[model samples]
Target: MHWRQKVDYWLETLGDEDPLKIDLLKNLSNEKLMEDSFYKDLAFGTGGIRSVMGPGSNRLNVYTVRKSALGLAQYILDQDDDAKTRGVVIAYDSRHLSQEFALEAAKTIGRQGVQVYLFDELRPTPLLSFAVRHLNAYAGIIITASHNPPAYNGIKMYGQDGAQLPPAAVDSMVGYLEQIESELLIEAADEKQLKKSGLLRYIGEKVDLAYIQALRTIQLDKKAQPKDLYIVFTALHGTATKPVKKAFSALGFNDVIFVKEQSFPDGNFSTVKSPNPEDAAAFDMAIQYGKESNSDILLATDPDADRLGVAVKNDLNEYVLLTGNQMGAILIQYMLEQKKLAGNLPEDGCIIKTIVTTELASAIATNYGIKTIDTLTGFKFIAEKINEFKQFNSHTFLFGYEESYGFLIGDFVRDKDAIQAAVFISEAAAYYKNQGKSLYKILTGLFEKFGYYKEETRSIMLEGKNGAEQIERIMTSFRDEPPGTINSIPVIKIEDYFKRESLDTVTGEKAEINLPKSDVLKYKLEDGSSICIRPSGTEPKCKFYFAVKGKTAESANERLSELVKAVFNSTCDLALHSI
Candidate 1:
């Protein structure tokens, strides 16, 4: 059917009760708006569906959520009978309609006769992951868009292992989702009936207790004097306040101060432009609180609380935001230092990081005799590695992180856990304070010893259907005619993850890449710098990542600026045309 026909079908079939549908119908003359809204179905990728909330096939609305939930229900039913009994765990973050979406998913699954353990209120993404393991559920669903803006929301699926569903399972779920036609027609079980039938159970404190208990085991130097190390924490109007405070207080960090204005769960995220911790602007309130309290460190977590951001007082006595790479480096160093001091640093222990993350991780791990394993760009791949190593007992998983502010300290929760990270980061700060140092100083020391390493990421937003095709075209152009040099730095090697091959530009030799296939291209420069380009799996943007190593920080910064300018300039024409 044509896009216009789909739009008309939605307009004619939608119930009169939905204001969104009414508004959409009132704008029927806007052909561009209609086409953009009905051009294609919102994609259900490996991370599940994410989109702006509205009344369209491409939007995240009640109908779309119900359709996806029904698809998940069908997938669950296809499994063994025992799987249905095992059921699913549902959690939601502090996003608009997050609670509504969670309930919708539960009811939809219940309609299929599958039991569901739903959180009574909003919870972090990590808690959802933990609930899946604690309850031994067959699967989990989290209603969150992570750090996206107020206009957007999403639903992510998790496997029994408490990690995001792998590619194969996601593909199967997508197959089932495609079979769903007319989201308006998808039937959901009545909520009251689902509850009375014992298929829908509301859970809260019990699961929270279990998850908190599990987090305590990862705290190192819990006895350290946290009183001497004042800390400021902000949830950015998301869901991190409760678990973070509980964990910190449990570890005797009573000097912690919460940014009261941003502590509560607010879907609007009224405090910042974007709730993402990676953005320095998100920490403005926290930094103010930090300075007023004379705090040692300020930490912020994204809405879902799976990613953490840190700001520490630098030499000028002002709070300076640390990049995700810097924080990951500090955490790695701290975890390894404590483990080695306690004589628990296993010879086979390994650190897992995404290929796009800083090479400083590998450099630091080398000094401790700990192996560093590189995975694809998502945390699921790291979780997959943790499962793999556990099954084989070949190596112990020490820690895992990605460049996008996601970190995992232990294997207890099979996802990037900011709750666990908050506790450990606090403990690390206390340990350094007792030694007469700060996290900033420690970070600088690491840079000095490991050689200055800098990494930067740029994302070009391309919205709607035409944008996706342009993104594909850009990738194709780069793959076909790989850049010879980035800022006069020769491209010595090209790693095409999609082709599962590494080509030596110098020798024209090809080698196999053992990781799963992905639409990512990485170029290795002669000067030990690297550049990677790929479209975001969850957003309508093409991202470029650059990493450069230099003899000093200034040189690295200069080189980074040059490379960024050159890469963007090279693609300027294509980007402008696409826009």
Candidate 2:
């Protein structure tokens, strides 16, 4: 159907009581806006649907939420007999309509006679993953946009293992979603009716208490983590405020300061320009709080609280934000050290990171007598590795991370847990302080031991359908007309994940990659630097990852700049900047 026809159909079918129906009528004259809204169905790919909240088939609303839940319910019923009674857990963050969307999903699933475990209030995404396993639910859903602007909201679907749905599962669910025609026509059972029928149950503190009990096992240091170390934390007006407070209080951290302005569950995220912890701007309030309180470290979690951002005080007494790569390297060394000291460092243990992450982490792992494994980008892949190792009893999954700030240390939660990361970093800060060294100094020490590694991630925003096509063309160009050299540096090897093959440019040899196919390209330079390019799975953007290593910090930073500029000059004429 044409985009205009889809808009007209929505206008015809939706009830007047619906807010989106009213919005459609009010904006009938705005063709550009209408075109963008009705151009296509909101994609249920890479977990679930995420988009601007509005009155179109392409936007996120009550109807889309119901439609997506309907798909999950049918998939559960059809895929496994046990999944029917196993039920699904529903949770939401602090975004606008998050709670409403959660309820919509619960009602939709309950209407299908599937039990639904809905949280009583907003919670972090990681908790939703834990609640699924805790309740033995068939699947989980979280209403959040995870660091996106206030105008957007999304649904992330999780499998029974508490990880995001793998591609095969996502494909099965999409088949069901595609069979449904009109989003406005999908039906949801009445909330009161579902509650009366015993298909709807509210879950809160019971699960929270269980999760906290599990958190106790994640503590690395059994002894005093330090009474003198101070911390400043900000939830960025999301769901982590209460949990973080509870975590710090439980960990015996009395010197911690929560950033008051950004600590509450404000959906708008009023105190910051962006909710993403990767953005240094989001740490402004936390830094102010840190300096005022003379804190040792500053931590910020995104809206959903699955990814963590950390800043440490340097000798200059200024709070410096650590990139995802930097923090990942720091955590690898710290966790392994504590485990070794405790005499529980598994010989078969292995740390996992995405191929785009820095090699410094691998070096750190080697220093501690552990091996590192690389997977395709995204935490779901890491989660898959966790499951694979447990099933085969091959390797102990110590930790997993991606350069985008997502990390997981314990298998208690299948996905990344910012709460766990915050606790772990706090312990590291105290351990270092006892030795009269700052966290920044420890990071520098790692640089000296291993090599100085620097990394930068940049994205080019491409919106709308046309932008998506452009992204595809750009990716295709790289695969077809490959760059033999970047900045006069020889491209010694190319790993094309989509083809599931790696090529040695000099030797003219190829090797198979034993991982799922993906639209990613990794180019290895002769100088030991690497570059990776992939389209963002969740957003209409293409991301570029650059990494460089040197004996000194100055050399690493300089080479990094030259490589980034050279990559752009040597390839497509696309603008890229640090996101």
Number of the top-ranking candidate, with TM-score as the measure: 1
Which whole-number lDDT from 0 to 100 does residue 144 have in model 1?
Answer: 95
lDDT of 1 by residue, 1-579 (tens): 688988878878887877877879788898877887888888875467889998788889988998888888899999999889999999999999999999988988899899999999999999999999999999999999999999999999999999999888888988998898678898889999998999999999999998888888998776677888898999999999998988887778899999999998999999799999999999999988887899989999999999999899899998998898999999999999999999999999999999999999999999999999999998899999999998999999999999988999978799998988888888898899899999999999999999999999999898888889889988888788787877777899999999999999999999999999999999999999998999999999999999999899999999999888888776532232444
lDDT (Cα, tens digit) per residue for candidate 2, span 60-148: 99998999999999999886678888999999999999999999999999999898999999999999999989999999999999998
Per-candidate local distance difference test: 0.90, 0.89
Over 4 Å off, model 2: 569-579
Residue 48, candidate 2: C-alpha displacement in angstroms: 2.9
